[model samples]
Target: MSTDTTLETPSETVSPILKSVNPATGEVIAEWPVHDADAVTAAVGRARVASAAWRELGFDGRKKALLRWVSYLVNHADELSELIRKENGKPLEDAYLELILAVEHTDWAAKHAKKHLSAKKVSPGMLLANFEAVIEERPVGVVGVIGPWNYPIYTPNGSIAYALAAGNAVVFKPSEFTTSIGNYYADAFAKANPELPSGIFSTVNGLGATGAALVASGVDKIAFTGSTATGKRIMAAAAERMTPLVLECGGKDAAIVADDADVNAAADGIAWSSFANSGQTCVGTERIYVVDELADQFVAAFKDKLKTVAPGSGDTATYGPMTMPSQVEVVRSHIADAIAKGGKAVVGGPESVRAPYIEPVVLIDVPEDSLAVTEETFGPTVTIKRVKNNDEAIALANASKYALASTVYSKSKGMEIARQLRVGMTSVNSVLGFAGVAALPFGGVGESGIGRIHGEQGLREFTRPHSIARQKFAIPGMELLSFSRKASTVKLIKQVIKLKHGRHT
Candidate 1:
């Protein structure tokens, strides 16, 4: 939340330019234009007009363009990764992983859109027996996407790629912190398909106000990703126009380490889940439950591995500084609350000082009511609790307000435990596995927000279902609708209902 007045970028190259700052070293990387309300409105209007023709191009042509975009991303993998790393302060490796997910999504959506969205035959029912019925996906005009700063590429691409493949033009307003990366992706598409109008996929770089403009711009739909609080506001804005929206927001995901689990593997997984990208991920593990028997072993092993990662500048580093400084304060307060409530820091404490980066801290015996345990810490901190059995682990995990995603560590009981957890997606014996599998839907319920983002749900989120029913012939029982039914016809209807609906009596 710390805003540096140092101009984000030169105004000539791009108006309303954003300053790209490197969180790890407090250096301004670069700046690009900050688009205004009028510009964003124009972008959505352009998409609306462009979609009229784009939709007619049908599935095959759109798929070709998306596939070409994939090739563009793959050829410039290193370049894109660098752009992501510079704009958002994640490690280069993590940035590469994000790009990889984007590539996979592009290919998946292109290959599977027709299968998921194309017309499908359905039963016409007795009332309309003479008619045929089918369900098809229709492009919902213009789709406005407001992406988050974390995982800027993959998360936004989840909606963008799918919307494009479904034949809808997109107006993307990336988070102010990661506008440059968003611009880079949009510009690549413009280069790949010069015939596509400026609005087929446009990027407007600005703050919250610009996003609000898009929501108010009469776009057919809005796909947004960010904090749960902000998501509520977006939902309200979309409600103003009765616009349909898909919100993929925050989560307080948990991980369970059963007695049968491999302690080393669990420790390694927890380290990655909690500290990767400095714990900015929406599905990152915030709370961990271990069987009482293995509680001490996990704490010791986890601490040993965490000590190996030095948070600041180094060639051999596992994590970088937090992308946003305000998050550092939130992490600080959560740890303090845990300590005040009789929790012990097994590794580093608030006393441990570091500038932008915080030492990976592990809290033990934290009260379930404590903020660190109940809310999303979104930092390199995790609360470890001892559970008597798997049932207790499941209960504790489900007690949170957010039910986005979760992980399980066991050999035989992994799938069973995963099924018992109240989450949209679970990674059995791994962390964040469902997201890597493009076929599975990725989203949440309850406070974690509604709607799906990946897989078939992802493709359909941007499209409307268009059902077509054609009559083959008149029904033999036309008397039913004509009010001319006879006693024998009523008797026949009763007999058929009994035979079809009731058990053969």
Candidate 2:
């Protein structure tokens, strides 16, 4: 949930209110009270105080509370989805799809928290055979989550639900553009479980200043989803306090079309992955590298598919306008740059970038150094290049600074191609399929950001392990820990070391 202006704190502090504007019509949808540093501090303090009680509830107790919140979300999904359509400017069907993914992920986190976060016993080493070793997974207290706007519900819920299920209180600062949606999400948890403390799930609403304050608010852990640049700033700010961070950032995800691929199916899946939500998806397919053998058929099929996709404010439209206002210029510039270079637009061109709604723009044979191929174009645009072979296609796909996600559309060699991609998650024979599995960890490497926020990894992200060892009995003359140990003890240790580890190569 980031933009060029995201997380920018003003030098002169003033009461800056967030005026949520509908991107489709430039209408003022609603105004929200800004939360300053002091307000953010208070929210974190409250969450810190509630963390104790929340952790004391144990796994089963916490699971029940989480499920209750999920039910509330499921029941009021329509209302929430409607608001998402209005504020976020996504189509109603897309909004509903987002809600479904969010609730399903929340439910998975609730049901699986105990299995992933419970205390467990471990084997004692030979030297400590008389002792029992146990490891306890303890909550890291309060976590501050800075969410994204492109995925207002699903993305934040990835961190929020997992953190809550792992027995940590959460202080969430949603993207300022979707303040109401963020508040409505946090409020649902309170309404579902009246017995929980006020700070178990809370929100701090405002612009970039509010988010920056959350990082400096002394939270035990920070989970953020946005652009790579913003993530880097937060990483630096979080370092001062040695706070743990989970950053799910930007992606210039690529798709590889091998000679043995299903041309039509590959085109359809890539088209959806490229243009869905106006191509604002962090894991969206922004680049395509097709083998020369299949390049002509693939490009033709992709063009046919793009003809069915259009961006508009109408309900029946395939997709909606760009949620972030500043991103429009970024899209326009990328198109202009690609054209200025020797790239040819086969389907849509510069005229496609109409404000708010950017019609699908597909470029062929664009220079690899062009902005559309190098930087993250969070709009309805994709650059397709024909490579000599799979090796060349793989090389070009892995050249980007972003290593977030990618897709491979090879029928016979899907897995082979997918394994060669330099990304956190890769969908074989499909596009963006990794996101549908709640059990799969989601995040990235390099500029894509740090850490992960799903599956067992997500449950552990908000926790720290505490190890305990108890002695069952002590040998009278073999007390290794005693100061009065005999010289024979040293001789025995030397003999054991020679008989054990010393034998290994």
Candidate 3:
């Protein structure tokens, strides 16, 4: 493990309460105190107070402040990316990309929040036309953002940046694995805007308990990114308070390689999609279904790419260690289970893991019922299955309980196959492509998760729509208020409905 210890310790430490344990070396990277419940409450309270003032600034003012933040992040990308790499054990290149994308999200949210969430004129039926109609999208007040370890900055900033730009105060609780990265952002943001209350962009340090508290802390909404099981818990807790939540959870995403695909390109995309970031992405492809006609050629090419690839520790590696140590066992069990059920490791086998770093494993003939194919083996593992054609490929890809993201590889049939996949976002001839497009919505269906982050969907997710209607004039009849409604009035209403919504002669 490379420990530069480059961060300057504050003269007045907040608390030596939280500790970052390196997944590769099992060494302590940094230590800080867990914020107490009182502290959390104080932060939330301050956010509530700050929100009033912040919201009063209007959309343009808030956009300028957030733009300044984006400028800061882009200018100091290296410093932020390094912090993320050290804390989360991801390659610096990947970290740098995540950092830059996060800044993009910030800029998008700041620029688009007003257009997406502002009041607009709405139609009112003739009966209610006396008053003018409008629909307003209002801020949800305080939003608690509990981010994930993988893509730490981008994932949570999807919510944090949106919430802030939408006139809502954010209380950010980053994953413990990447808390320092979160802290660095929070501190930098504070430095940039001292007038902004500490709570408006507060950072709470702790574990799951802190997150649970935030979910139940009377916040108007909660935005969470993590495992499906944990997402369920967060949803249930939020249910008690009737607070809305955006849950971005795990996915057993898959890719399909049709007979007409560029075999080498497909292989490259598959390897990167599955093993990049040590297979720690919610949208990462965990399975591949190839048409039997091209299965052999694809597998051979994929194995060739896999041969040159290796999981290692360092700042410059293609991928890094599993951010969470416990995930190692999950990966192992999945491999073991696949092998037990007639699966063959085309390249790497069960012995791929050596402490924190797990070499990429490519398996074939894995049964559909195997744990590796069904569960989220969030490590450097990919299971390949044979299919008859595009239909079979779609079926297998949709078979998993997760439907977050998918990739379809084919020259002519790529888009057709993508449309058939059940996943929320499908990349045609590309891997993780939707995330790079700021206009696309990112989320899942089924157990993979609900609610979208990024793009226009992201800006709308943190706001609530309020529709108002004004009556221009009364209907031709007085039947709307009186108990005795004339048959003519009923006929007129039916005619109006049909004229507005139905095809006319």
The TM-score of candidate 3 is 0.91
Task: Residues 190-247, candidate 3: write the lDDT tens digits.
Answer: 7777776666788887776677767767889998888887788778878988999888
TM per candidate comes to: 0.93, 0.98, 0.91
Q: Write the per-residue lDDT of candidate 2 for residues 1-505, one digit (tens) a residue.
A: 2342556653337566788888888889888888888989999999999999998998899889988998998999899999999889999999999999988888899999999888899999999898999999988999999988898999999999999999999999888778889999999999999988899999998878888889999999999998888898889999999999999888999999988999999999999999999999999999999999999999999999987789898867999989988899999999999999999999889999888789999999799999999999999999999999999999999999999999998879989988888899999888888897999999898899888888999889889999999999998888898899999997998899889988777
Candidates in order have lDDT scores of 0.83, 0.89, 0.83
| Whole-model lDDT, model 3 | 0.83
RMSD of each: 3.8, 1.3, 5.1
Best by lDDT: 2
- The local lDDT score (0 to 100) that residue 10 gets in candidate 1 is 18
Scored by TM-score, the top model is 2
Model 1, range 414-501, lDDT digits (tens) per residue? 9889888888889988898888899888898887878888799888888888889988887665566567777888898889888898
Cα TM-score of candidate 2: 0.98
Off by over 4 Å in 1: 1-17, 475-495, 502-505
Poorest lDDT segment (10 consecutive residues) of candidate 3: 1-10
lDDT of 1 at 48: 85
Work out candidate 1's RMSD over C-alphas: 3.8
Residue 20 displacement (Å), model 2:
1.6
